[model samples]
Target: MTIHRMLARLAALAALALFAQPAFAAECLLGAPGTTQRVEVSDTGRAMTVHVPGGVDRIRNLPLVFLLHGSGGTGAAMLESSGLAATSDHHGFLLVAPDAGIPVERGFVWNIPGVPTITGEIPTEDDADDVAFLAGTIDWLAERGCIDPDRVYATGLSGGGRMTSWLGCVAADRFAAIAPVVGLRAGNPLPDDPQRPDPATCTPSRAMPVYAFAGADDTVNPVAGGGAGYWQYPMDAALARWAEIDGCREEPETVAVSDTIEERRYARCDGQARVVGRVVAGRGHEWVADNEAMWMFFWRYRH
Candidate 1:
């Protein structure tokens, strides 16, 4: 072969090798099971912890669940305590735990729309839009983590739970289902009556399936209502509003989930959507959701 021809061939080979290396690295980052990494989600410095239990060579079309943390909490803390990571490992799904943009003390809190945060600060235009961040996370995972866009779900705790409900309200089309623990909401409270949910604040584009878990003894977000500006109404009011939105048959049924766990559910709704709430007796304002049950519930829907 001529020296010039050989040099051209070597250049082409080098270019191919150069281009292939990053692709392989990205695949290894995504496909290796039990591997966790901290990723900067977008151009912004907002951090996210992603656990990819999928394949490197072939995309798994795996369901994705965003495990949001409570206020004054970080994504790492949520990943460690929520047990949803292990659940994802068992279920063969991708788990993403992301930090909210607003820094609070040692952690962060979500900038829920039109509601004051746990720090009593109402978000303005300057605050990072958490809803967009999370919704964008769906796109991110689909591109890099072998995620199924139709099977995305979200579950969160405390402030994070309220964020989950807000996502259900605003981004229902993106998520198949939502389970909010300890912080269920239907937007802000009625200006006149703080004990009722404001219907106009949260208008879902379509029917959304909701399963909320709470504790009977939790004074922070009591089922019967009355808390901070963001949590002014009872959990029942939120459920009822969602029931009304889903066009569920009125007069929900109450049953015993167990000797200590009580469930009230609204069924026969539009698109077969159901609104359910479970209260654990002697529990408090903390993470008490059954993770397996949440995955089972999430497994039912696909957008």
Candidate 2:
């Protein structure tokens, strides 16, 4: 082979390499075990705390869970109230909680679509940009090492739950599964009133696995409509919508998990998706299970 021919072949190979998949790299700094470390989301100055599990050094390919708080709540509050950090410690998964910045007391509120606050005001899109912050958090974590890209999951309470549903709708490509505690049905068309913002446009990238919970006695986001002007629908209706989105077969199997809990499981879904709803009897708007059920549900899925 001539020198010119060899040089041309090398250049061609180099050009082709540019189009190939790049190797994974961890650019962000890692956190310490059993501690919560705050990190900036971006130039936006939005911040979050990542709770590294106690045994992180011994685990590889860890699953990452984004735990969001309700309206007027903060990451610190969620970590304290949800009992998720202990769950993370027990399960060896990473947990992250981001601030929403709608200060009500010591906490904040996530700016979910169409949902207004107690004062009947909705935060504009640019006001929170939670979707971007979440996406950036995931990317930053993935780039930092020990994260299993396929094992990403999200769960939250009230406003945070709505945010989780939004992530399932808009960022489904990145999350393996989601559990929203008392969140609304994403992409369910709203009433034809022009005054209201259109329901969030849901375009899931895959047949997503969803395990949701709702309280029978909840009034904040009631099973029936008309409560503080927040989005309201029966738990069955929300589950049905998710089942349709997940391509599950009709007629879910119902089972009594406990005296206070009944589960409805959708079967034969495309892409191994499982859509489930758990109705908590005689309960109100709350994180009924310390988020253990959500973790178990999330554990079953991986992208």
Candidate 2 displacement at residue 154 in angstroms? 0.5
Each prediction's RMSD to truth: 5.7, 5.1
Instruction: In angstroms, give how far residue 53 of model 1 lies from its true place.
Output: 3.5
The digit string of per-residue lDDT tens for model 1 on 1-303 reads 999999999999999989888542133135367778887765666779888753333446788899889999998889889888778877888898999989999999999867888888888899999988887777766766468899999999999999999999889999999999999987778888888878888889889999999989888899888766678789889999999988998689999989999989999988788899999999999888998988898998888
The window of 10 residues in a row where model 1 has the poorest summed lDDT is 22-31
Give candidate 2 misplaced runs (Cα > 4 Å): 1-24, 58-60, 101-105, 193-200
TM-score of 1: 0.88
TM-score against native, each model: 0.88, 0.84
Clashes of 2: 4
* Candidate 2, residue 18: how far the Cα is off, in Å: 19
- Judged by whole-model lDDT over C-alpha atoms, candidate 2 comes out at 0.78
